[model samples]
Target: MLSGDLDISQAEGLKPMVYLVQPENFDQLGQSFVGKLLDSAEVDGRGHFEFEALKNVEGQVLLEVVVQKKGERYANRLENENPDSDNYMPLIWTRGETLVINAAIDQFQSSVTIENPSTVNASFLELRDLKKNAFLKYKNTLELLQGDEQLLEREKALHEYQAILMQFADATPELFPALMAIKWVSPEGNYERIPEFLVNQGVKWSERYPNDRWVKELAALASKEKLPILVGDQMSNLEFPMVDGSKTSLNAITDGKKLLVLDVWASWCAPCRLENRNVLLPLWQKYHDKGFQVIAYALESNRPAWENAIQKDGANRWLHASHLEGDQNPIMDSLRIHTIPANFILDGNGKVLAKNLHGEDLVQFVANYLGD
Candidate 1:
């Protein structure tokens, strides 16, 4: 149970709510976390509140406690949001444990602290605080060193900042904190170290928490990094069910083509449909006869919607295929298509040329590739 004295600076005009973060959407932190509403508490004039129902949760689940005004949207701790206005803090609530939080509502994230936390929660707090401190210390240093003459100093500062995270991630044996620290510096922040961290860190977690849901998800991400998804890397073969219910591979479609666009989209995505009409269709019309082709792969569950979208958009000229699995589509996982409208331009021999080109860039690239 989360029982504590919440010191709301102005106790009256505020409402406090608690929510459980869905396991699948845990990676999308600070985005939209309006998950299952577990409970709400009323604060007295003295600014004291409690959630008795927060006791005996099934397991160690992620929770967000937010204090917002009535009818106000649920608040998250965004990096860009004003610190004074943040009304939320993340919690790792463990079963059979009691966490007492004493915090001010106005500065919820920064002011919140727990007394005697579980192992998971303790690690979480330590890493979270470390991240905040590092950001404060390094953000200005990096910015000030942005000039070409200070490139070495900037690189040194960047490495020093990342080194802190890397060392923390390596040392913190707790699952959530290690994962959180790893994500903070992954792909963009840590770049080349993604594979190494995933392998070394992932192997430990995989063995320790083998059947855990989040562990499995992170394992998937680690596997994706191993696959060749870069420009100039030769793409592996992908086979999916055609609209006519025939199996066709991507390699088979690229025969005798100067360039091919491997378009990954979904029927339900409005932006995808708009791109089809605005960019892809025009490019297709102009270059279809000149040996430029497209294989539009839809991550769709509804076959009718898939067929209807293509028909509605008058995009029947392009070859279309799907596994009819929507977000759970195997093709999505195989190609690391976390979000679509994702695309890759390919050469005749199946090497990637460019990726995710859209709008004027798409038009310019295709036109330049296939000239008159």
Candidate 2:
């Protein structure tokens, strides 16, 4: 007897059909059992049934057969024709079917009793393909390692890992377990390699899946690490427009001054805004005549907010200006301003003296710089 479930709904108007025959007595079995079974049945689209032969025979072979109207080739063509289509349904395959059976076998080996011998035999075949994929990834990684001297070779290795990750992303939920296992086996090298790997993968990910969570997460990780993640050279000798609409270059701000404090800040930045209230204002007032000058660069995206902050905080006493474009501000980009509430204290002749000074530290820093 042969029995199994079949889903023909996706076939639309196509009918379900099957032919079964015994290899030993093909003519006899076909004329009797196979012909009789086809004569009594009507099948279309989707349905399930069970069957059993009435006669009890010793040492007799039984063959079960099933066929769906749609197969892998049809599904592949549909996917190829419509890239964004989600019409393909998951089907049992050599690898996938093996993974399912193997998982069950593993569970059974771990203590559960296996009442089926068919599952054990099917699991053995499934594991071979799983191992084959694992070996392929390993072999590729080794090949990548062989040509490490060339930059293009390293890029190729990075691409291989990225391709694997993309496959995992596109896989169905049922296939995820095996895909994840493959991903786990793929080697992720040290921190030095991480930046390059992420950069290459990030570009592909952004292009393919714009709103993917992994891309954002990877970007955040790279950003937080202070990696050279942003593609650009460090800004030097930048000229910025002051709040009064007068232009002042960084060189001019530092020129003829005993010490120049290039305070990079914004109105929206609570920390920068609060610095005046905390200690900077009082210190600046006390030290202005003692050769201290502040050139505050506002990195505010809003012009109104920048002006409002400067006025409200009484920051007028300082040499203030802004490009009014936040991160895109030419001066900030030139300075490579990664973190806010940052500043560079420069000595006479426009050379950097100290960077990122704040609070009482700024007072102590100046006192030490001036030998006070």
Candidate 3:
């Protein structure tokens, strides 16, 4: 048997109502059942009912509920709108409340806060547990780093950051906002290392949850970075055929060049073809003599189309080549080229300088690097 009480008081204007559920009853219901129960709640006229529900996976029940007024919009809007926002929904867990799940009645309030920004209070016991796990993982990794006498301090710090990120990845889905917070605080220079960790985590997550959209997105993001690294680091040793039917090594092609831009594109890709007219042609014309060069690697299954597109685009001024086998191109496979119109910029000595820079950024990057 289970029961609970919800109370709402208004002296004058309308205010949000509080819903409370006993932890014992919540634990008995299971996540799916509890989710349905919460779904049945009355929708107030204020656009949505924002509440927090606690669940125990093993117990299969909800423990408690905390209600608050939904923020004006969803918390995740920052990802698409601002690209940078520290505001994450807070999840608080008390003695009886072991898990905090936030839900909004309307789609606009989809995002939930992981930690209360207004109070800066870490009252949530679940947050403490996550932090504890992260600290333990960091300590273990730090010990390993200490044992390696030959490893530089810089390498140790990189490994330690990776360890902490792994802890965040292992956290529950509800704790994602907190994970994002940690990611935000991470140094930008570690993006390369971090993506590798994320890819591993994505693989693990995909295995655990077979058909999750978010998991797929995470995996794609990780895989995206791997493409450049594979080409710049591992495949640099191999020689490939140029459009003129002559063989050339990537190292030889880029020798002594201050910057080399690899444009992995296809004649069939509309965006790739479109950029030739609007973006690439102009930029190349302006920067070719300024120590910047483009190497367009076309992936066209049809040899004629590849040749035709090259001629039509007037790409003669730059280095253009194609394997004439679409996805079957060994270079494409080596680089894990999943999307068309991809690009990478490498500085002198074959070091990757920037990736996926498009439109204004691409032009600006060349200007900045060439001191224009």
Candidate 4:
């Protein structure tokens, strides 16, 4: 059972309600991709609430406690909403233990403190706070440095941060916190390989916490064969319905004829919007007739917003497709994409020629390949 007391005595106006949310792995737009409304209750005049949860035997589950006005609509924490206003805080749960939380409405996230068997959760919080403090301390110092000096300072800070996290993970005596902290800064991009230190730690953790969900997930991530698709790898096939109810497929459109740029993006992603305006558009104009095509596959939940972005960004020239399922879209899952503004450039033979080409590099890559 999970129980908590919300000290909303200082809160003004409407009576607040507390919601127990089984938060999704990632957020879609302003909402959880697949959040389950596990439980909800109106806080009494004294401000207390409780909910029974199934034992998380496999591993820790990330649950969210959302406190808001009785009928007020608001966005989830990942949507960049006012965190303090929503009184958002993430909670972790494990099997065979009862957890309690005490939070004041005014203080919310920062003032949150847990009770009984929250050792792992508490340690993770402390680690995160340490990182936050480092960022604050170095914010001004970073601005004063130039070029390589700035880069070196930032790298030094990152290394120090990782060392501190490792020390916490080593001494915490909890698999959940250790696994999370180790995986948090795992490598990605062209060098999509887990660090040796993390791999060794994962091996020890797996031995310690056998059949643990996160351990297995981290082990898979640490595995060499699980690397992300690179520039030379074959592109994953994706087929889905367009807004007009027309079907689109990467293989079908490319058809081993024109080179295809598989642009995986979303309307809500600011980086995606910037790349479309500054990179994709110019490349399209230069290479369209020379047998280059762009399949702008949008991962969006809102049909109107997706269409609006296309119109606003002048991206209607290419074939666009999406089921508007956002992060829940199967195509996204197949590609193992958790972030947006990702792309793959495919040759006429339906093999990946390059990936994540950007700015002048995007134009140059296409122009060089086509001999234009």
Candidate 3 lDDT tens digits, 1-372: 111222222212212443443312211211111322231134354433443333322333322333323552211112211111111222333434323233332211122333332122233334434434444555556566553222333244545545644565555454333334334324232344334455556667677765765555555655654534633443364466788898877787677677888888887776677667667888778877777777888887787788888889877678887777776787776665565566778876667777666666777888899877
Please, what are the lDDT tens digits per residue for candidate 4 over residues 1-372?
677787886777534766767654322112443456566666777878777545433465666666654456543322212223435556678655688888886556555678754666787567545544544454545567566323434444555545665666666676655654563332121123224455556577778876866667657655534545555667656676876888877678888556888888888876677777777887788888888888888989899999999988878877788978877887767665565566778887668777666556678888888877
Cα error of candidate 4 at position 18, Å: 44
Each model's TM-score, in the order given? 0.51, 0.39, 0.51, 0.45
Clashing pairs in 4: none
How far residue 253's Cα lies from its native spot in candidate 4, in Å, is 1.2
TM-score, cand. 1: 0.51
Give residue 335's error in model 2 in angstroms. 1.3
User: Which of the predicted structures, 1 or 2, would earn the higher TM-score when compared with the native?
Assistant: 1
Q: How much RMSD separates candidate 3 from the native structure?
A: 14.1
Distance from true location, Cα of 88 in model 3, Å: 15
Task: List lDDT for all candidates, in order.
Answer: 0.71, 0.47, 0.51, 0.64
For model 1, what is the error of residue 293's alpha carbon versus the real structure, in angstroms, after optimal superposition? 37
Q: List the residue pairs that clash in candidate 2.
A: 8-45, 235-334, 242-321, 243-321
Ranking, lDDT, top scorer first:
1, 4, 3, 2
Considering only N, C-alpha and C atoms within 3 Å, which residue pairs clash in candidate 1? none
lDDT value for model 2: 0.47
Q: Return the lDDT, model 4, position 299.
A: 88
> Cα RMSDs of all predictions?
11.6, 20.2, 14.1, 12.1
- Which residue segments of model 2 deviate by more than 4 Å? 1-235
- lDDT per residue as tens, model 1, 99-181: 78878776666677789877777776776677667656677797676644344355456556667777787887777777766
